[model samples]
Target: MPSSISVGREARKANRRLSPRAMFLREFFRRPVMVGSIIPSSNRTIRRVLDRVDWGNVRMFVEYGPGVGTFCQAVLDRLGPDGQYVAIDTNPDFVAYLRDTVRDPRFSVVQGSAEDVESIVADHGHESADYVLSGLPFSTLPPGVGDRIVAATRRVLRQDGAFLVYQFNPNVRNFLTPHFDHIDYEIEWWNVPPAQIWWAWKD
Candidate 1:
């Protein structure tokens, strides 16, 4: 029988071999409502999301529904050595793939729901996050689930921190308005189905 160490190594290798698009497709097919999109986010959408962040002041960041980590690499690249990143995804496959692919000490991958952002962020030894990014499909989620996630996001972010969300529809803006002091919206048509980006901040 293979040793546990050998089994673990094989799992990691398998995860590494899975492409983001393939993983997205598999997960989407398995759970359309949970996976949200049929394909991984495009480079254009990733840029629009990351570009809105004030990287200079960001030290701790959290990502809700990281999926296959399309934005993970870019965020890691832009982070300083001391910067910390944590990603939460309810999909077990995505969580496993992220753990194997994003090999960075500063990164933490959690297999949990986005509504638990506060406790999850605390598990990583953070009191509050500088930025919280989400690729979650708010329009597809149940009203209660979406509200809880949005409320948790506001509670866990520092006063000066920002929340960046990208969705296929503009409905997310309505959900964010009550929690944030200010909100800004932009559209990226270069993406597959196009995307709407929202940058929200509190005083």
Candidate 2:
């Protein structure tokens, strides 16, 4: 008989050792709310969660770890003319792809560090955003890096809005807890290996 294992577990393993291409596609799927790392092989579940949010009154949506622009496209499609989307990616390729591929006036693609999301958000003329979604790898970043990203998210997200993050590693929950009023998480058992999506919301 074959062993039956969860996809999340597989992703967790793959995450510990990701191929370059797998690393690339993982961005096709997720954004984390707390940390600042990208696992291109683990994003489908992240997208699934974002699709469930009620985006009606959301005028501005900011995405960290835009990666290859998977989440960026989703944000642009949902955010109407009245809605604006800004994506921050340190990868020049992803940032350039985002800028060239997505031409909507409501979309802005930036190449920058996830830790500086606050200034990025403010530079875009947003003091507080309706939503700040992230895909940064929180588990592997330096200690204060994850906290900084979360802090920036909190600084920008509106009182009634959300700060969503995805993590393959459960190691950073401590930092994630103090920054948000509510935190929600899920295990994606069907992805390449699988991953966890943690939504940190403050309202």
| Top candidate (TM-score) | 1
lDDT of 1 at 190: 89
Clashes per model (N, Cα, C within 3 A) = 0, 23
Name every residue pair that clashes in candidate 1. Answer: none
lDDT of 1 by residue, 10-123 (tens): 876776787878878888999898878898888888888888678888789999899888998899999988899999998877888988788999898988898988988888
lDDT of 1: 0.87
Model 2: which ten-residue window has the lowest total lDDT? 30-39
Please give the TM-score that candidate 1 achieves against the real structure.
0.92
Residue-level error in angstroms, candidate 1, position 123: 1.7
